[model samples]
Target: MIAETVTAFNERWWNNFLESTNVLKKTNVFHNCMQKQETASMREDVMKIIRLIAINNIPEFGFRLYIEGKNIASKELSSFFENFTPGNDEKFEEWSERAFGDKKFGIIINRGEKFNPTLVEKIAKKITPLTEKVGIPRLGVTFTIFIGNYGWTPLGIHTDGLGENVMHFHLGKGGKTMYTWDVETYEKIVEPANRFNNTKIEEILDKANVFDFEDGDIYFMPYGEYHVGKSDELSIGLTLWFNNHTESALAKKLIDSLLFNNLEESYEILPMDTSPYYDFENFEDVKKLFHNNFGDKNFLTLLESTYRDYKMALYSNAGFWEPPFPKAEKIDHNLNFKIKIKEPFKIIYYSDSDSLLNLFIRGKKISLINNSSIIDLIKKLNSGEQLQKETVFNTLDISWNLDIKKYVLDIFFENHIIIVDYA
Candidate 1:
């Protein structure tokens, strides 16, 4: 019966572990602040980097090494493990025990979502202030227990697919260690070429920050950073990753809603072969194709209004018609300069195997024709070269087959990534 519950990826928010009030402290919850004066401010500053915050004296989080007392005879702890039945929040049920070939890889006991052990709940209760103070909305809590000897984890540098996570060591002996670097540092220190070999992270560890925690220590690492951890001997720890919303997340939320109906299966893109196939002479017809589809102001105007709806939604999400924050940065009205492809977003795409069109737009897989003309169009737009209005119109026209072209145009104009004003 349990195996019947296939775990689908959860996208909605559920972080309300406890009521939110006075969540941040001018000082530590169990001891002094790491930076006494800025302890409160650090709560907010941690957002700038991927969340990696640790403070001493978290207290009673891991009084015992495992579920049983640390001093309990090893045989006794072993006996308890042998007889253990999961409570409610242990997060391990999804995997079949044989998921891995080696038994020594250890077992992850899932206690189910409703079952948070007393110690686990205590840590979460203590953390509510920090998150509440930061003003990031919390939806719910998720936690798990890891039981194994030293070097037990996959230990490769990786990022979490779910929401934000907090790791706390309940009990362990020997060197259980964690190392991490922000996504920024990761893109620099580790060459993209060697990313496949897991050792790249370890080789670059000297350049990354290291985190060491004692029993009962609490560490918060925000989502989307590269990290890995391991212990020298058998250990037990609890991890919580709850859904949290940010301004970018809010923007994404609105965009996702607007495209919900047309959202197709996501396609992962690989690096393209840059070698050319068609001569530049072939592009004249491609140019004609784009001009015929997008030469008018009507499509551009529809695109602008759709984005206005997004900005309005953004304001309402803040419970106001205009948010206190400055206007969206990408919405510049300046049309005099050449339109350049926006920097900062990594582009990925996939085409319909049968139709041969490449589709893409910020995770929305856009399909365009597979010919050299289309490839040339994509590279030109991805490039930062100044684009004239003819260039701008053709850029949108290049991905001609996607039904959601209008939404894509709306996004380009709204975000100001595809400037139509380029002369």
Candidate 2:
């Protein structure tokens, strides 16, 4: 039998996980500030290139995609699409020939070097504060992209079964298909015992779901959910998949703590693999193992408590939103912008006399905030108005020298702290 009542299991598995993990940090705040700061200076059309990485739980579908029509229908990509198919079938070539018939490559920049330098500059400007605020090793965002033309819709309802998290962002119309199971139900469905063992395609497809997704909308489906996608249009989208082992060290530590605290006859060690262990047939045995290992009262207790703590961590983190602001050359602070932290702590201050800001982390002097005018610039930036050098200089009560104004604004432009609009 399952360890708890459906209600109890639901409490432990799905809702709790969702409530706990979705959070945006000061870095996120700073990212927003930076994005706003540069919005005016960057080319108008280029700003749409911004993609948020947090919405999806799956690492595979984590990053955003900005594709143009020409690139989607390009010869090189078309050839690649033709040469490769999702299921390694001949149909890929057949589909590829039709999709690429006459279309020329559009200007598509998949970030990094391939993207226009100006566009990159604008993005980097916005992205910097968030990265710095979050204390992530690097400010650059990374996610996978799978852009191909699947002309026909094939209904082979399959679960990723990889035991890793994934998020699907469907670009074209055929519609998504699935019967989303809540975590407990999902876990049970994919459990060693009830896995659609040797089920026929027709049988599984009957239980599948179909849904719609437009250009910017995103969906968050956590790990272990069974679903599929079919597109009637010339379909293209990005699927973010994380190979197992992406969970936080805190999560693992919590899990270990629970295991150690619970369990009747203490097992000597915990065995973990980055790959899914159960296959098609040995599920029952695996379920037996899970119950034997996890169903113990001690294990359950630890699971419950650690899950709560992790959930709390996520919930707390979610509430912390900091957008990156453009830094100004003037307005020095009593304490230096550069910080050195020996241990984790919160960095709290004021955006102004009335507004409060905070940054949380474990180490000291992670980096320097540097440019002094960033706070005032963020205030003006958040106003969502044009930020001319004169306007900034006047607001900060600084000397109206053109050379100084140009220098400060130049730094802002170079750092993507402010956006420029040519038109």
Candidate 3:
């Protein structure tokens, strides 16, 4: 019976579907025959729309914004505010200020079951068809809303959190959402020391590639890609969430096992190499060593197996994993630049002087070196010799701490250089 219900539910489209007075409507109708019961199809429809947009296609039509160009019914507005109870008037004011400021506010809505049924119904009716087509069932009928003011000042460049792909639909008379993926350009304007930190949202939004939306417009953006939005007037919109929850759950589990269960041994079997061989060593061997020491199996499999244990510990007892102390890497996109560390590490290249790119390894800045010096260092150090400080530091007039210098050397040691202890 459940299968039949699902089949019938999946086959029907809510917006155009008319509950025929005939047996056809009755076929999928919800009834405890002994007791009269009725269930609407909007919930199912909402699920369908999420599915449609998730597959990298904008649905044939975007979302609808029902507006009378007048204030929403006071009673309806009051009802809508019920679930949005302010912790205090000050808290409400704070939320409103943040939401209405020139910048975009991403309101991630979860626990959808807590919302009033009528509010849910209205949004569901508008969203169901699009979500249904996307096939992202995890999105269900639940959704999120992004609030903001009119114009560019309000929304800055930023990407959604990891694992969340959103189908954004505008729902106000003049609602508009703008976005783009030119994160490199965005970085030029908004400097996020580390993009993963949530508060860096403003910086991220500033750099996003921008596209504007009119009422009924829809756009799809996968997680990890940066974007931003603005509205011409007061705007309301819906963004459905679909993420790889299962994979994420497993990843968390695997991380927990690595951190807690085998932490002592993990340090022993660290993903490290001491072999003097420069590039000849098989990276696979290093990988296998890690697998053997950390717990036998591929990374993905290890994640899956360890997740259950992690879940138990995480839920029953509050436990979390702390990332290992950071290591840093320098990233360069300026290919035309030639850098040599002679004296002051002067770099000569035709890169956008205005662009500000952050180099990170494990979420910390090591330093930004001239690209030429980086290239020459790779070449000079690749001979696999313990590089002398004079040959290394003298070539690039950079001041260095003994430890930081060693850390830099470790990067070269991995593939390009060997530490020659010429004291």
Candidate 4:
């Protein structure tokens, strides 16, 4: 049943919707494109995730709660969870209702993709054509989950981060209305300080672009638009953010990466010298230090190489900002098993120099000595075909050590780039 819905989304609805709307150029809504059953399934999956988060007490997952238009303090949330008991979904729902009374409340969880693999898989499949139309953003993609009966968005009417656009999937028990204003129009009416968190919604309603949608609908908004949403009844939404970085930002990231890779951590502190005068004689020594540390490559060359590495990792993960956590258990390579690449993920490889083959899988880079046999094996694995363990083993160069071959295979299994079935 899920497969049928996915097929419809990928083949028909998405294609037609894209043709009808200028996706990144304007704001648009598609209604009833998804089935209610699918939304229910998504709700169940998200509820399970919320339950797990409460059970484990994971504050780092970026959970924000608000009641009656006020943010809930972290310390209070910690105390609430400390005394709370996690049980079935119904228990959690009842507890929340009682704890917050009848007041409107909202829950926003960042990094939604990390918690729900099923949701991520469906989203990836649906967005494949979009990515084909507009290449993946250099900053990659991320998602945030919004669940609540909040009357108005906590942040009020505001623009997203620079170069960041959003696509919201509404999984609803109730309807939602979105209000948007162009930059010029909003600035003319609202004060500079009131540009964000503006509560004068009634004043701007007449001039705003209003979009009201129900369950199983999607809303896409381009970057730099001032917008906010209102949901008087309980609802859930997943917003996918396509983050595009400015050139300067991308350069800074590359520089940071280069520094991280080249510099060593030091805890030792250097005491201040008695003399206040600058030491001009040591300037050459500082230059020599950086020259030796960064190797013989020119600074520009190093930056270019870092950028390439970033691109490879981003593309390998299908533009996701972060890859799934690697599996914890050590793989048993000796056991016979059929292995296949995971769905919606592809292994990307390139040869920068003649002597080395770079393989990017699940956003990590692995380098092996360039060899035709190994290259052939990568192509076979990437073809999405299931192959016997022995066939994979035989594809490796016979001259290579057996341990080396096994180690290469283990990397794929550990990173979940490939799934193995013992049966």
Q: Which candidate wins on TM-score?
A: 4
* Candidate 1 structure quality by residue, lDDT tens digits, 200-267: 55568787677766444445566666777665454445555555546566455555644442234444
The C-alpha stretches of model 1 lying farther than 4 A from their native spots are: 1-104, 109-113, 117-120, 150-152, 162-169, 173-175, 193-201, 245-423
Instruction: Give the clash count for each candidate.
Output: 27, 43, 43, 0
- In angstroms, the error of model 4 at 21 is 2.6
lDDT of each: 0.41, 0.35, 0.39, 0.80
Sort all candidates by lDDT, best to worst. Answer: 4, 1, 3, 2
- Report residue 91 deviation for candidate 3 (angstroms): 23
lDDT of 1 at 66: 28
> Model 4 off-target regions past 4 Å?
1-8, 48-58, 81-101, 275-293, 329-336, 351-357, 368-373, 399-406
RMSD after CA superposition, every candidate = 22.2, 18.2, 26.9, 4.0
The better candidate by lDDT, 1 or 3, is 1
User: With candidate 2 superimposed using the best TM-score fit, by how many Å does residue 179's alpha carbon deviate from the native?
Assistant: 6.0
Give lDDT: candidate 3, residue 87.
34
Cα-based TM-score, every candidate: 0.34, 0.36, 0.32, 0.86
In Å, residue 82's CA in model 3 sits off its true spot by 10
**Higher-lDDT candidate among 1 and 2?**
1
Q: Across residues 201-256, which tens digit of lDDT does each residue of candidate 3 receive?
A: 54455444556655554555656655555554554455655543455564664686
